[model samples]
Target chain A: AKSVSISVEGMTCSSCVQSIEQHLGKMNGIHNIKVSLEDKNAVVIYDSKLQTPVTLQEAICDMGFDATLAD
Target chain B: LQKHEFFVDMTCEGCSNAVTRVLHRLGGVNFDIDLPNKKVYIDSEHNVDTLLETLKKTGKNASYLGEKSAQ
Candidate 1:
């Protein structure tokens, strides 16, 4: 598995963090996810052959937050 | 433009903000977020499917509550 950290914007509460975690957690390639509202980012672990950092970032973006890959 | 009523599972300011951002990003849409009621009323040229799909992108549970008015 590969891990990626994505910077997320516009979340205001713990519910926001939970929502992202719940939604992305159900995806096919994702193994685990941790969303931090305080840190304004999501760290995701996934199958490298099945997902890319860009795809993860875009998935978060599609969920209405401004998401970008974090080095 | 037509007004459509949608029920989105919004629990707090963050949820409502997510709704706001997605609708705004879709463009050509004017909307009101009733966070307490978990309702979103959108005035747009987009079809019901398009609007609903857009709302679902927020990773919230969203359902169409039918049309409201023609404005």
Candidate 2:
């Protein structure tokens, strides 16, 4: 498994964090996910063989938030 | 009750739902989310700061769009 941090923009509330967690939680390959309102970011642990950082970024953007790789 | 307008950076129905659920759960607050316009009209007893803070919990950026007539 590999871990990646994504900086997200346009998040506003606890429900936003929970929504992100729930959506990402259902995706394949993601093993762990942490979304923080204070940090404005998400740390995702996933199997690289099944998902790419770009895919994760797109997934976040798809949900209405802007996202990019932290590093 | 007071009516408030806001510009919310929400991209999809899911985002709108998140906002709706969060605000509704707060009680004494009603929201009409205009997805295409990226705007929300809220009828609430709470102050702008409280509503703004509540919206922030959803992880979406929200900006006040001026007050409309009370309902």
C-alpha lDDT of all candidate models, in order: 0.91, 0.82
Top lDDT model: 1
Q: Assess candidate 1 and give its lDDT.
A: 0.91
The runs of at least 3 residues in candidate 1 whose Cα sits more than 4 Å from the true structure, single-residue gaps closed, are none
Model 2's lDDT to the true fold?
Answer: 0.82
Native A-B interface contacts kept, per candidate: 0.81, 0.05
- Candidate 1, residues B8-70: lDDT per residue as tens digits? 999988889889988888999989889999999998889989999999999899999997875
TM-score of chain B of each: 0.92, 0.88
Per-residue accuracy of model 2 over B23-68 as CA lDDT, tens digit each: 8767798778888999988988899998887776555688898887
Expressed between 0 and 1, the share of native interface contacts present in candidate 1 is 0.81
Q: Candidate 2 regions off by >4 Å?
A: B1-71
Considering every candidate listed, which one attains the maximal TM-score? 1
| Predictions in order: chain A TM-score | 0.95, 0.97
lDDT of 2 by residue, A1-71 (tens): 99999998767677778878987888899999999989999999999999999999987765557789966
